[model samples]
Target: MLIATWNVNSVKQRLEHVLRFLDEARPDVLCLQELKATDEAVPALEIEAKGYNLAVHGQKAFNGVAILSRFPLSDIRRGLPGDPEDIQSRYIEALVSAPSGRVARVASIYLPNGNPTGTDKYSYKLRWMERLAGHAAGLLRLEEPLVLAGDYNVIPDARDVSNPEAWVEDALFRPETRSAFRRLLGLGLTEAVRACDDKPGLYTFWDYQAGAWQKNKGIRIDHLLLSPQAADRLTGTEIHRHTRSWDKPSDHVPVSVTLDI
Candidate 1:
């Protein structure tokens, strides 16, 4: 099974890019983040026409996520379980079975991007990560093939960013933020791309400002994390870098994993 993730920025505006991707990549499943639109606002028919069943969790003009799969989806989860007051449409999960009857639980995540250092927004980001950690710990016990994919908005390490010095004061690169991310991996979840390739320039996102893309100033914020069972079946990982060059394309590109399910 081939599963992929991309932060389309806005599904409505990126409909053409999304459709083109579905046709070209043909991944069995795709987890999308940063919809920036309501579920009703998403161009569902256009995507469904490409043979995908979608589970979307969206809010108005803000965070949103979706899971599109070729196979039937069950046990669809629309929101993260740890917080009831938290209403951001940032997480969604579903279970899909490969033709061989193997099932994998997949999630689309748009982790908070806490900008500035000492504010509620920053605090919320940490709290959200903690909630995710608590929830993820529970999922790990299922012992099934689970894939948590999305735009984590985390620059994992100095190697992940083109200019570490430039991001030192940024919330995404803060020590606390990085530590929370490591906690997830410490739970035995294997980062699919890193497991296959450790090359430094393997970035998944580039900013549109200040000639970042032209200078190849990018970061590996987007990720596909696999549970032990899923990691075992992993065959390869790909970062569709060329997608960034497409007309009015998303800052982030599609990252995929091919597994021998």
Candidate 2:
């Protein structure tokens, strides 16, 4: 099955572009982050008209996430389980039952940006990462085929960013943030893209300002992490660079991975 993740930036503003991409790409399952809409405002009917079932967890004017799938989806839950007080439209998960009867529990997450270090928001970002690690560890113990995909808002490494020095003080590249990210990945979860390609310039997001996309300056923050079972089935991984060139495009583009079980 082809499973893809994208941070659409804003679902309402980029509805047409998203629709166009869906029609063209036709992935078996699509995960979205940064929807920046509310549940009542979600374009569910429009998306359903496209012949895919939808699961959405949205907030107002900021973070949100959704999952669209052609396959049967079940056991859906909104929000991360570790923190009840943490209010952010950042997570959604569901079980996709494939034709072969294999069920893969998948989550689409948008991690905290935590810009301007030494602030409460920055501390929240680190705390969020800790929660994610706790959840990921529990999921690994389940030993089920699981995939966590989305915009992690982390630079990951010097190679993942276009300008390493420029992002040293940025929340995405801070030592604490990077270490937390690495710890999450170390929980017996495989990063699908890195498993296939280690190239330095494989980025999924660029800033809307500073001519980042125009100058091909970007960062790799979006990711697809898989459980052992899912990792074993990974066949291909790709970043749709062309999407950035589309009309009314999001600063972030889609990243997809194919799997055969």
Best by TM-score: 1
lDDT of 1 by residue, 110-189 (tens): 99999977999899999999988888889999999999999998999898999999999899999999999999899989
Error of 2 at 148 (Å): 0.5
Candidate 2's residue-wise lDDT over 1-261, tens digit each? Answer: 889999999999999978887898998899999999998898999888998999999999999999999888899989888878978889999999888988888999999999889999999999999988898888888788889999999988899998999999999999999999889888888999999998889899988898899898999999999999899889999899899998879999999989884
Best by lDDT: 1
Candidate 1 — what's its lDDT? 0.93
**Clash totals for all candidate models:** 0, 0
Candidate 1 regions exceeding 4 Å error are none
Q: Distance (Å) between predicted and true CA of 154, model 2?
A: 0.4
Model 2 weakest lDDT span, ten residues long: 80-89
**Candidate 2, position 15, lDDT:** 92
| Global Cα RMSD, each model | 0.7, 0.9
Overall lDDT per candidate, in order of appearance: 0.93, 0.91
Using alpha carbons, what is the TM-score of model 1?
Answer: 0.99
Candidate 2 scores a C-alpha RMSD against the true structure in Å of 0.9
